[model samples]
Target: MSVLLEFTIRSDQFKLGHVLSGSGDMRFELERIVPTGGHTMPFVWVSTERDPNEDLPRFEANMRESDSVQELLALDRVDDGGLYRIEWEGQPEGLIKGLAEAEATVLEAFGDRNWTFRVRFMDHERLTNFHNYLTDHDISVHIIRTYTFTEEGARRRDFGLTNEQREALVLALQRGYFDTPSEVTLDELAEELGITKQAISDRIRRGNEKMLRPLLLSSAAR
Candidate 1:
């Protein structure tokens, strides 16, 4: 059985986060990570509430001058954001190395001020190793939650969520979107994530349905 772990780390705690600390109001979503010999290349989607035309240049310049960034490439540019491939210097330490050592798969990761990572390990032992590795390296992390992946009958019990859905749901919960009178609005969440209001709305709605279906069905059967 695989275990999923969700945790949070401050921007100042990780090398990649330190390099991007001057990214202004830009929000980053890590699309994928590729390990190459001692180095790691991460494809990230960069977005901002401001105009990308003005922000992108500053972003590119910062990365080029950062000691941590070995190489940078702009893969795609959209209206609001762009995709970038960044190769980091050999990381003998930090979050990337720890994940690699524990054989964890990063399911979703994004942040502006701080980062939240949802990752999976083969089992509880691997998850424990990951925690131990981080502690050994002096990397402090706040674990948000953990759950085991299991199957029942012909159904998949992993909540049946897409990455986008999971992100939306997590952010909503964190921001108190479901609070009485709502502490946050959909538009605000959209702006913070550099996404459109409609997109966020659909994600929350669909995500709710997927999660509720299983629980509601199980209750009725009982």
Candidate 2:
């Protein structure tokens, strides 16, 4: 059976983490990683609460300084943020490396003060191997949760939702916003959640898509 696993690790301990930690308030989101002959290239999206132009140069310089980073290329600006391509010079570290070695798929990853990763393994043995690899490296790995990858399980496995998204969804459901009669409006849901109506709407829309993609694809095949 396939397994979906979630774990968190501090930023100070890993190479990419070290590179990202230099830019205070900047958040890194891993988009994709491709393993080359003896290296891996990671495409990352970076955003900050402040202006990107104010912090992007410094962040690029930080990436250049890291020995593991062979080359750093600024891909483009994404909305209010920036996208980057890094030529990783050496073997990756932490869970990223472990997952790569095990041939597991990293479904999602995001970072701030700490990074959270969602990884999928083919079976229990592969998952165990990944856990053992982390232990051997003396890297602390906390299992946030684990579940068999199923259509239903996808909805509950976090799906890249922030705490706010989860709360908004739960509150909306409890208040009957999803019902035909619709007991609550977006304004009411936002007021109860203490966020803007637009914010709540975006959260619900994105969260729904993320959780439903798996089921949608499965149904399309049949």
Candidate 3:
């Protein structure tokens, strides 16, 4: 059985996060990681609300000065952000190393200040090993939740919803947010989850769309 883990790590604790501190309000979403020789190269999308033309140069300059970054290549520019590939000077330590050692697959990873990651490990043993590796490295990580997926569970959880979305939807259902009269309000849900009401609302809305889209499409085809 595969185990899915959701955890949070402080920006200063992770190498990439430390390098990206220069990005100001920019957010990074890791596209993929490539292992070369002894180093790992990460391709990430840099997003910011400010003008990319004005910020990109500054961000690049900051990254270049970082000891962890050996080479930075601008891949492409999108409407909201640009993609860049970074080559580390040496082998990455901490989370990346632990993930590689445990052979865990990064499902989702993105953020600034604090990064939240959803990773999948092959089994319970691999998850244990990954945790042990992080502990030995003295990497401080807060695990939000873990789920072991069986075949049936995987099918049920396979809607395009993210972990946050799924959690929001589940809590909403449990608290009668979907009821006609509504026993719970968005504020309550957000408070319970330690997030803003707007965040909770967005998750529920997006989650509903993700879960309903496939079913509605299939039914229409039928």
lDDT for each residue of candidate 3 in 1-222, tens digit (9 for 90 to 100): 899898999989878887887679777877777776877788887866556677788889989888888999999986546789999887778778778778888766888899988888899999999989988889999998888766425655578477888999999999999999999999899999997675677678657976886689868999
Per-candidate total of colliding backbone pairs: 0, 0, 0
Give the lDDT of residue 215 in candidate 1. 87
- Clash pairs, candidate 1, are none
Q: Which tens-of-lDDT digit does each residue in 39-112 have in candidate 1?
A: 77888878765667899999999999888888999999866678899987667458977887787888678887
Top TM-score: which candidate number? Answer: 2
Q: What tens digits encode model 2's per-residue C-alpha lDDT throughout 1-222?
A: 898888888887566776777777777888777777867677887876455667777788877887778899998874447789988776667656777787788787888779988888899899999888988988875778988878425565666677866787888899999999898899898787776665577668656866687668868999
Q: Worst 10-residue stretch by lDDT in candidate 3?
A: 148-157
Better of 1 and 2 by TM-score: 2
Q: Assess every candidate by TM-score.
A: 0.70, 0.74, 0.70
In model 3, where do residues sit more than 4 Å from their true spots? 151-222
lDDT of each: 0.82, 0.77, 0.82
lDDT of 3: 0.82
